[model samples]
Target: MTKAGIIYVVGTPIGNLGDFPPRAQTVLAGVDLVLAEDTRHSRKLLDHFQLHPKLQTLHEHNERELAPRLISRLQAGESMALISDAGMPLVSDPGYILLHAAREAQVPVRVVPGPSAALAALAASGLPTDRFCFEGFLPPKPGARRDRLQALAAEQRTQIYFESPRRILDTLQDLADCFGLARPASLSRELTKIHEDTLRGSVGEILARLRDDPDSCRGEMVLVLGGAPAPRDGPELAPVLLPLLAALPLSQAVAVAVQITGLPRKQVYAEALRIKED
Candidate 1:
């Protein structure tokens, strides 16, 4: 009787092909089948390594429907490997459904770790890595994105997020508005590539840099924002909110101040308006 073959959740290189581990290559070559987030993208990786396995599409759209069948294959002593287009199989990528299904079926499951953009950026971000949170991607809509940032405003641990090149400036502006212009942050783009770069400073500084240098706005970006400062033993309102009223319109100032202070909008607005009157 044959034993069940293990399901390998593999991580691939985010950029440099040389980052692909020997173990990952062996697994991909030896597997009975390989599940890829994007077959076309993974195809190039496989071809480069010259290790072709049966490729099947298992992305966010089809992973649920295909998971059961894939799980059955694992149960039947057919080893399989799962890979994303880049980075880990399921870090802001797909393969969760099938992995969960495999676990439920009591099939052997394993992970062959490789490169991760989150960790890559965080390590070089010059922020506190001892405690940090990975916020994969913000909502694309402005209102929703700001709302999310507002919710995370007081987070003490450093925050990491994945963002598109085109949206980086807008996101940085939003970060400045929500976290305050002085909030420390880092932006790393095209990690491990020839043009890989990291910019560290206040959110406003990075925003200005990117705006002036359009060349930096052409690749995937990882954003790391410093956590809010510890609360002082006093009314945490005036020092933070009053200045915004001086710098911006009443409503706009209140909106940003509320996000930064986590205070009630009505109260901030009233105070801002009073500041304007005074």
Candidate 2:
């Protein structure tokens, strides 16, 4: 009996076709059938390499219904490949259903890494790359987005995000409020394309740049926002902190004062001591 087929999760180019890896092309041509997130989008890619595998649509809306059938084909020893509109199959895209099903059925699975928008943006931003995080997209709803931003207000790692072109300005405004206007950031758009641009500055500067051009925004944007400022020297404690401590318990008041005034814990504790005695 022939061995069960393996599922190759391939990553395609985000912008430039030149980003395609030769091994991915070879696998694309060799697969028994190619499952695409969108046939029309996949057509452009297949056309580039003259690959015409048996095509099937496997997007979010229809993935569950079609997963069992696709797995059965794989079980019967037909190797397959999956590709998304851009980038890898499952980074904020569909393919998870098929992947989970494959594991249950004991089929082999593999990856073919390629251009990732999050990585592309981060590498080009010139920000501190040693530590970073990828936040694919915030909640679409206004209230939820704000709540999330507030929760991340004190996060100290460089934050990376992928945003739709239309939401760029609004997201910038939100970031400015949460991260402060002078917070450094980079907005890279039309990446790897001829007219690609990366705007690097404080959040306010990016907002102004987008506002001035009006017509400049036309593609997805990768927003790399700087993280929270590191702890600075403690604020002077006596005048600002003592009065608040008067009504509160020693321990609770000092803790609250540390947060508000950025005062050192020891210094705040001492002020609380002096005030308690008075």
Candidate 3:
């Protein structure tokens, strides 16, 4: 009787090949197969480390149909490593389905930590990292993107998102409008690469810089927005909320007025109290 092989979740560099973890090489060389978001992209890493395996492309498109095939190999005592085009796998990338199937088949699973663009950018951002959230990407439509930012307004924790070079300005504009034009932000690009740069400033300032000198940014980018740390409880809206409460019932106007500012009633109530006093 033979034991089933394990599936290793390997993390790779987003840009600089030098960031590749030494353990990633060892695991890949030991695996019988490699599941990658893009075989060609993974090839560059493989060449750099002088390690190779039977690489297979398993992205969003073919995940449903191809997962079974990979599982069959796993049952055959073949261990495999799953990697994304950049950073960690299934983080704004694919391979979740395969991972799910692997577990269902009782195959062993292990992770080899590597570089992450989200962490790389967030750290270089010089923004709040004690607590953060990864938004991935906003909707492509300008209106939708703006709506999304408005939704996340007052999130409190720093927000990190991925965006294409072409859409950087637009996304920045939306965040500026929703989070406030003067909201501090950082635009990090080619992190770990020779041209790695984390341009930091208010949203408006960064937007202006990127617009004036487009060449300053290339490749992928991570946008970090400083969020007000989540209020321990909720916001104390009593001040601003008090005035409205005096004019109308607390329950009726609490939601309506807070809608525009995107603050909780507790926060608005605290503001309401201040409004009533003055």
Cα-based lDDT for every prediction: 0.84, 0.81, 0.79
Residue 268 miss distance in model 1 (angstroms): 6.9
Q: Which residues of candidate 1, in runs, are more than 4 Å off?
A: 1-4, 239-278
What's the TM for model 1? 0.88
| Candidate 2 ranges beyond 4 A from true positions | 1-4, 231-278
The per-prediction CA RMSD against the true structure, in angstroms, equals: 3.7, 6.1, 5.6
Count of clashes, each model: 0, 0, 26
What is the alpha-carbon RMSD of candidate 2 to the true structure? 6.1
lDDT per residue (tens digit) for residues 131-157 in model 3? 899999889999888777767876888
What tens-digit string does per-residue lDDT give for candidate 1 at 1-47?
11248988889999999999999998888888999988899999999
lDDT per residue as tens, model 2, 1-278? 11239889999999999999998888888888889988988998899789888888998999999999989988998999989889877888899999999999998998889888889999989888999988888888778887787677667789998888878888887776555567778999889989898999888788988899987677878999887666543345666666777677777776666556533345556667876676
- Ranking of candidates on lDDT, top first: 1, 2, 3
Indicate which candidate wins on lDDT. 1
Q: What RMSD value applies to candidate 1?
A: 3.7
The CA lDDT at 210 in model 2 is: 89
